[model samples]
Target: MIRDIDVVVIGGGQAGLAAGYHLRRRGLDFVVLDAQASPGGAWQQAWDSLNLFSPAAYSSLPGRVMPGQPGETYPDARHVVDYLTDYEQRYDLPVVRPVRVEAVHPDGDRLRVGTDTGIWRARAVISATGTWWRPFLPAVPGRTAFGGAQLHTVGYRRPADLAGQKVVVVGGGNSGAQIAADLVHATDLTWVTQRPTRFLADSVDGRALFDHATARRRALDEGSADTGGVASLGDIVVVPPVREARDAGLLKAQPMFRRLTATGVEWADGTRAEADTIIWCTGFRPALSHLAPLGLRGPRGHIPTAGTQALEEPRLHLLGYGDWTGPASATLIGVGRPARDAATAIVELLSLP
Candidate 1:
């Protein structure tokens, strides 16, 4: 049987929960479709010791605030997950948990969402599946034939797994730094980097970097896109790579990997770095393989949703997009606004003839 809903949200993370809650307030008939067992996407996948740097005040959804520690610096990963779960139950959002969506395509005036559970028809769709849906690994020689324990940063949860082992982390991003910092005291670790990273400082005293980035995004939006161009787009918070690795005495300031070896990684200047494990912190890809037929992705598989007031798909809107800035371009704190706007847009589409 084809069940019909006014809107079908494909994700159940903070973004999706926020969108779903708002959609209900807008009086639109909607159902949330989530692949996970419950809400909280990245929070569930992040390291055990991880916490949001943006404090509790800015992390709230449309109408709710994080339950505790509103004046605190940030909440840990587990707290975030707990909050999302509460948000769903509080709003009575119709979330179909653990329903894997196989494909979604446009049907005459609505979108046909096919899942293992059943087929759902929605007049509009809010794609809050986040930009970090897929983990991106670099293609390095001998990567497959490596004789060591290799894992993506996503799979890493605690330093206990890496304790007492010589671990070499690939990529100089924030994730890599955090993992290395966590494991340094318990294990022998080395961090690898080929590209220079921009290091944005952690919030000073109680001030958050998120506030700084928000202002920067607004300033960048002032210029005309006709002359400014999307190429000029950059992140609101650019954290330099050098500062993050500064504390890793042996691990700090290492040159980028030239190639991967059976035993370890090799630097560009012919230096060989040996380790027992390799953790790739390369970053993530957008979750849109099911929507490949839409042909909406831009360079390097990124969904280009900036500058445009709304997405090209009248029924579909991309969230957590844009390399530079928007309502919610690339951070957890930035996700709410886009979720609100997208939900409103979706509700409007559903109400129309």
Candidate 2:
């Protein structure tokens, strides 16, 4: 027999935790199912040295304040995980751990979710698995045949992991930059990027740099003469690439690789850079395999959610899915409203005759 509930949240990450918090506060009957043994999802897997660019000021989740010194710098990945674990304990959130949900299907005014543990039936489901489910690995011919050590940015922890090895860090995003900078001290590093990203220093009027997104939003609402376009995080936060490398004589910037061979990376312009290891920092994708039949997914695999690109489905919602818009819709600070609203919607759905 399948266990039944009002709602079954399909993840237990930050987004999922936020969702659960609101659900509990609203006195709703729900269960959170997660594959991981604990909360804090991808955060727990982050590199030890990794710290959020956003300071503790704007990083708190709903209700619980992130414990730290005021005007202090951003917290590391471990701090984030610890905070989330504390949130779970404080709320007594009904989260069932180590349960991998395999599939979900609509079933007669309800939904049936299949997991390794058991079957679960719910009137509504919040699929808050997040956008980092699948790692984006570029399709390069002869990639699999390469005999060198290759890793995705998700698995990369620190420079010591690649000490003394000639490493080729792929992609131009924030993660790629940080990894390259960290490894420079311990290895022969080549930062192979598709294109040089336009960078900005992380500060404003000599104040502790806040998210440029916050500034842009205020500019629009105030109707000031200058409603500047979406500003990049590069404008406010100090990116590792700019702070450490490019400034120091540590890393060599190279063009993106056109092809891959057993020996090293081959650039589009017929240039070759030999590397002992290749780290793909190409980013991630949304995992919506279970959402296949929803038919709400856009041109890309992303779903067009209502609150935060939440779906039209009454109780279904998504937080932090990407768009060309300004900053991440799914940031820890931004997720509260959507989670609250989603909980409200779920409660209303349950209360109906």
On TM-score, the candidate that comes out on top is: 2
lDDT of 2 by residue, 1-353 (tens): 59988889888888788889998998878999888987788898997677776666578779988887444376778888988899888999988999998887777888788889899889888887776778889888779877798999888987777889988888776677777777888898888887765455545311223244556555665786543433443422355444776677665567777788888878768888788999998988887777776666676677665554345566565654542221344567766666787788778778899
lDDT of each: 0.69, 0.74
Per-residue lDDT, model 2, residue 268, is 65
Candidate 1, backbone clash total: 9
lDDT of 1 by residue, 84-121 (tens): 88888999989888988888888888889888988998
* lDDT for position 12 in model 1: 82
Taking the candidates one at a time, how many backbone clashes does each contain? 9, 6
Model 1 poorest ten-residue lDDT run: 229-238
Candidate 1 TM-score over all chains jointly = 0.86
- List candidate 2 segments past 4 Å from native: 69-72, 204-242, 293-295, 308-312, 323-327
